[model samples]
Target chain A: MAKTPDSPLRVIGTSVTLSSEVQSRIRADLGFAIEFDVLDGSACLRRGVTRPDSFDIYDQWFHSVDVLHTAGSIMPIEVDRIDRWHQMAPMYRGAGLASGAPGRRQCVGRDPADVLFVQADNGLGREPTHQVSMLPTVCNADGFAYRRELAANRSGPESWGWLLEQNWGARCMLSQDPASSVTEVAMAARSAGLVEIADCTNLTIEEIDALFVLLNRRRKAGHFTRTWPTHEESVRLMAQPSTGLGSLWSPAYFELCASGVDLVYATPIEGYRGWHSGLCLSAALESAMCDRAYAYLNWWLSGAPGAILARQGYYMSVTEPLRDVLTPAEWAYWYEGKPATTPLPGPDGRISVNIGDRRAGGSYQDRMSAISFWSTIMEESNYLQRKWLEFVG
Target chain B: MVPSSERRSSSSRKTSDPIAERGGGYLYAMIHDLLQDKIASGALPVGATLKEGTIAAHVGTSRAPVRRALRNLAKSGLIRAADGQGYIVGKGAAVPLSSRQLYDTLNGGIGAVDRTVSAERIVQIVHGAIVAVMPFGHYRILESELGEHFGVSRTVAREVLWRLMEQSYIHKDRKSHWIVPQLSARDIRETLQMRRALEPQALRLVAHGLPSAFLTDLASRIDAVLADFQAVTAPRIDAIEHDICHNLFEDLQNKRMLASIRRNQIPLVVPRIFRRNFPLRDDLAALRLYDRILSALVSGDVDAAARLLEIHLDRAEALMLARLRVLSVLPPPRTDTWLSAIH
Candidate 1:
């Protein structure tokens, strides 16, 4: 892979401090001479390229990966050694293929889900695999990042709860992407007796409307702040005191914390949501490169270098064997990452799971179930999105 | 304490100062500081009636300096008055709700309340409310009844009269203000139907994405409504319920969607009477739906939360229909006819 910096084959990712550091670490640990091009992962994802010949790997939200896979541009992998890879979360195992001939390679890497890239301000990591196409990657822990000064001035997490309360809805800041649909889903789920939508396979209008009405209350209360068009805008909004409450990933946000912006990153005592990102080799990549990509994937999933990085400041989807990377202080900060688990909507107002359930290693079927649920939501997302636009406009 | 000669010299010194000499920057600064203090102290309340002659006398200055200060206050929304009323203390004597209030009146079923509000009462209240604060010469209201109120020529009254109607604040027929029209249950339902279609998604996005403080504020506001609802007597509940919901809808418009639901929809629904007695059942039902919605939001169940909103609107429309039947407000609901066309 002797390509130039702008080589069509170079995979680009939007990333910040920890991720950039991870990139350098991967280059050194693997001792690969190949140049790794790292850009803003979000921008590249939005570009939405499907041809594997042009870019060999993509590290972004897994939702986009599924979209690309559906487009038939990325090749899928079915290496026999896949079983050897460490599967921390079942999401790492990849989803079953529903279309195209069997054995057509799809998804190259082991766990793009665990990538450290996140929007800057809130530091909430990119979409967790659970919320997107299932891939074995890093599972992002959700938390709040506050401007150090503003956070210090406030008593504690309780001050931020004001946004979630009756009169304070407009003061909170969050990502507005239709893809990461967490904050909206969480509010709706809370209203629907804590029924999570991402986990459920089917959803009805009543459940959707209940969520909408709850949101409407917040709007009526004068609590909403701004609807950022992109993640970067949200990050910038979070970074300043003039703006408030950055909802973002743990590792990614830690870098912002280290830089001296006072932010409090916490999972709601009632549990917030996370977006899962992972690698899915498309059905179109060259077999040899796909094999190499799979090797890298397996290596990442095996959890040595990734574990070391996680110790530094990140959460991986697949359970890893790392010890002592995160100190007690860092662990306290990290423990709240997945503090609240949410339930997904099933059918007829029924729910599939409770948000409070502890997440553990997923059974093999978990990956498929999650994907099936996500696909269903995406299928109806256009309609929901249209309604959202019409309603809010 | 100074001698007359010294005083003359000091006065001359003032005239010779650079700010006074050219840009009058110092003079402006002094006046600004004085005005700022008066405003901050609430001594010079916004819209407090002011006369040019009195201000000039009080400031011990010519009308020019005072005029500049008035202009600045006017720009800041701190001072306003009716034409010939001079400067008042506040901005536009409390906008109450602008034309959006007409929406609430319609929504509250004003026409159907106990006795018919006579055209004379309507004209007096509407004209007094409008003209009491209307800037002088803003429009000429030529309607004869209104012209009689202002003792103005019919030509001037007609202009102002038509302007109000055009803004949808009021409606007029050949003889009287159109207090009642082709208002039907179907029209009100159709209008509400549009709100149901548009508001829920916008609200979900806002609740999902709004900053923390806004959310908390919302929760408290909802709680306040709950408190108010408990406090009101059953007979007076409808008005209170309408007020709380109206404020909430306005806030929603301001925060998200940015669409004026009240301005566009309330007018059509407000004038029609509730067909059902104790409209509070519908009102309470609507309020409870929102309460559940807020809970879901705190819990983070976006889909279920959104679904509830749709259900709430549907139920509310049903309640409206039932109330309309009680009041004999429209023909019976047709099962097969499309609702949108009726509006």
Candidate 2:
């Protein structure tokens, strides 16, 4: 099916990982028609896997690789085709890179590295291979952001339980994302001594029922009425004084802090919920469009775009490419866990990091190592989503 | 109040029951397809004026469903409306068949039994649709919508819901909402345990009285499927499963045991619905397992065949879960007018 050259290369992803700024930049640099569509987390994953003919590229969580690969929704991404495969993070390579270093400890949840490689059987596995289901693009460690007024100078490591605390009642927001939000709530329930779960990622139906019972009780008491579905909505809510806290991403947190809210992105002693985003070609994308989609994937690793993400507190898959792109001061503040000597402007040209401000949780290595969960589609994902609806009610 | 016998007979005469086919579509669908088949076969000749009452009596249904079938056919331009009453069979041909000849032809040709599509059929159709989507997520079934969709009364729709409720396929929550619950991993495993315990015994009962020719026929079908599974269609796969789950139990007089075993066959619905919407990617696991079971049965090794069937159930339970995981990522391709996803 040959297409007219002017037909845009449509890319679909959640709004958190995509921005109009990125769209404008890519269009200007590549000089082609590009369609950027933002969908809810589940909607994006659904269309990505089931309706590959709808878009050229899918940008979403690596956690989806299992279902995506199993459905054959995505084509195998050739590592040889990647411009900076060798420069990419070892953590994302395979099982061999998962040892004897600062990243020595194995991940607790569904590690992106574990399912990174496309095995000879055309399934995802930890075994190293040349082909991949997706190209790891951006990543971050997530937790809720809170107001200084809500904390009141309380000084120990923040607790995930703070989300369920009565003090933040009604003012507190919940994530609209079923998988990510439920994991956060499970951690909070576990941390607060409200419940004991064997694995936060994989909860039994009884456990899920118990957690939702508590959540429903709290919701009836008006504890978590507000929820945000997108990063923009998250920032909008967190920037308000009435909204004391909720689950959040780093970009939204930075946006809130930069807008001068005395916001604190929590580093719960429990651990951060780590998540990674990647680019995948739709099974339907072919020939010339395939070449263009690959070009778009390569552009993600072109250092400039990765640096843009770094400004918002995200780590690229290949950090080395970003070293020269980001200033020394900027790199030290964001990735190396140092206080900023000067105000750091985000990709938007706004001073997102104020003078003397330090990154939360610490550096890339510190936060990532402390991760206890990764955003993934659990085996009980369908059940979780079903009950998640009952709670969100 | 009406007498109980009168009420029951009144419902039986409602024909093309919405209660029996809210989302199921057994009676009317059969009528539509049968009439279309007749038209295509030249059994309903050119310019045959299908009067509502005549077609209804001949098909053992009410004029309402016949009128509906004719209206639908007219919409498709397969037939056209006559000025006096009812539809003329040909789109353009206008010489009407005499009423006597039309009645004689329909009476002699169509074999729709009076009770072939009554309450029991409703159980099958509604149950099948319900089971197919149970693995996807929780869905709400509304009585009013069900009634509206099936062109049945609310009380009839409620009766069908009650039958499904008795089976635990659906339930009325505290708010009186009809809910088809999601099949969790625990549910799948628990259901599988029921299948393993009952199916082996069923295989034993059926295999003991099974004809050599019957077993051979089933084996040949399996062999053909194994030879080139890609050539097999979704409906063909469903038929193959029915051969084991229903047809194989033809000799088994234990209706309760057969019902129990078939209830545990909800696992089949996942792959059935999935393969129908997606391409048939030949897992061949079912074919291979059935081949082994058939060989045992063919050798008069009834106990061995039962053992193999138990193993087949084990494999089925796992594959069902895997298919559910894959299906979870997509919105169900089939949703009823009466059914809505809870989320």
Candidate 3:
């Protein structure tokens, strides 16, 4: 039970968090060797709940908090222990941005209890408390990426409706996951005048049916050439000549750019799909393991990891800390959406952005403001999955 | 109306009945009891016309007492006033009375004609039907219809409604109609969370005090299921789930904890609903996990058993949530006849 410098800290997360830079930094800064169990989305959820003792830390999206809390698989972290707890963006602190516009309604709600904050009595509350179910980490607005040549031929503003355009034929790709893909396609269906879903996050049975029917029709018509299950595959697909456009993650967009692919990560007039990722502690952690878990969580807030993730186009929950960690030029290029003054390294420590290149959306706030919906496991997700599989087949 | 020839034939058939000598208040009470029995047994079909003179002639009673009896039946929602005339049996008039409902209505001690029904009994019948149909979506609970169906006064029906409101099961809508809110995913998760917290703790409290032989037997049953989980039938899985999650802790003698745990039993009812559309996949992992928990309990390691119980609950919650998501897309289940819609 005694603490040791070489004690292994088991971290369970998606492949995005297990990047070489992120893993190496945790080992270097936290002074403990890290063991990672990188998994896909469903596997991560299954392991997080059923095998709490198998890992010390979980880095995943906020949507999984309900499942983890319901399972009692995660213990609340003391906000006092997080080094930059107060330094987080005002949105996390119950304050809206300067524009007075709200964050994505799917994730953040008007009530403090609606978010991840946990009170001492083990109920979700909005006001700051000693305990939090999870610590918010890297987040960003995501949208589709398309080949420059394909966009040059199109007129007018870019739209999510374009994904369903017969013009794209079988050249377009889509994400294979149900949670995000369903929301993305629903937005596209609505924008394309195919269906009008009331709430993208909690789709009803009828809306799910209509959306899937539309998707299936397009699938049978050979509208989609392929589907990408991972960000790496998504990047590869978007970089190909055959793929005119597809649902793309920020990291994959950066990866595509690093490979010198001429692509435009669109700020679709309709809106960007938003998502946030965070860290949670396993409830099984006790004594020294709890201490090491806290150390790993605090290290995530210490600016270095945020900076690394920022290079991949993610906004750290606490951007102030990242301001010092990143160069002024890199900050202007990434957060301000200004042209890069000089070449900048991607998350993988390779030059992905050259001088005079600008982000697609004007600024981080502007992009976050236009979020149409966030990735979520909707109440209708099982229906979405079954239909999604049929479309895939 | 009863045909004239049939009425004359039925009058001769009634001579053996004991009610022929009953008079005054007893005569009307006897008629009411006889009619109640007829309705309960579906002798009177829904929407069947019941003319005052026809029933009076058939039963060898004056129209006065038969009139009073029909009025009582109307008040109870078993019969409604026909257009401009006599009464007709209501839609749910033929719904077989539950034994408990009957016991509550009947004077069990003396078998006397006391027809007073408690609010609690009415609440139980209505609550059972509401919980059954609520997973489908919003439903209107007609106060008048409910009163008639349960053979209670409006005041008595209001008492049942107020009790259901206290439990957060049903509420009055804008039009003053009682509505059962749609069962949302959040509601399911919240209930499951409470179950995960309370049920495992309940298990821990009873594990040490439980008979070792009983624990061993339960463990062996679970082990047999786990050994061949892929071939296990749905009912077998349900039996094991009920034993561990519910039946085992029934003897804890802690009513508050047990009651709270019982209130969270909605998830337990979901498997049967989903099995209607989808084949129940054999979840070997859950079976194995439950087996471990039972084995730990059998060995008297309460802490390990409680821990494993938590894990099993987590898995169950996930499975139930997934099942509900699929079930949500399907149309609502057929409404039982006992459930009447106001709007």
TM-score of each: 0.37, 0.79, 0.56
Better DockQ candidate (2, 3): 2
lDDT (Cα, tens digit) per residue for candidate 1, span A1-393? 553433222454555222544666666665544345554443454333423455566665654553343233444344344544444443333422221223232221212332222223212133422222224455443444444444454443332243454332126655455444434344335434544443322233454555556656765665555655444455566665555554554443544444445565543433333345555553344545554555555655555644444433345554434334433332333333342244422111233224453222122122222221121223223224433443343
- For model 2, the stretches where C-alpha displacement exceeds 4 angstroms are A4-7, A96-107, A153-155, B1-117, B136-168, B171-179, B193-212, B219-231, B244-260, B282-319, B332-343
lDDT per residue, candidate 3, B85-132, as tens digits?
677778643344433443343333223322233455456666656775
Model number 2 iRMSD = 2.3
Going through the candidates in order, their DockQ values are: 0.01, 0.33, 0.06
Interface Cα RMSD for all candidates? 23.3, 2.3, 9.9
Between candidates 1 and 3, the DockQ winner: 3
**Top lDDT model:** 2
> lDDT of all predictions, in order shown?
0.43, 0.76, 0.71
lDDT of 2 by residue, B1-343 (tens): 7432222221222332233455444445556777887789888877877787777677666555566677888888888888867888886567667767777766754565323344466556667667777877888998887755554346557878898987778998899999998877777778789988988888877677776666776788788888888788765666667677756775568988877876776566677767765545435676788898889988888888888888888877756665667787766647778888775
**Pairs of residues at least 3 apart in sequence or in different chains that clash in candidate 3:** A112-A126, A113-A126, B76-B148, B77-B148
| Candidate 1 wrong stretches, greater than 4 Å | A1-9, A16-18, A31-53, A62-69, A82-135, A143-170, A182-222, A227-234, A302-313, A318-321, A324-379, A387-393, B1-343
What interface root-mean-square deviation (Å) does model 3 yield? 9.9
Candidate 2 docking classification: acceptable
Which numbered prediction scores highest in TM-score against the true structure?
2
Better of 1 and 2 by lDDT: 2
User: Which scores better on DockQ, 1 or 2?
Assistant: 2
Tell me chain A's TM-score in each of the predictions: 0.58, 0.95, 0.91
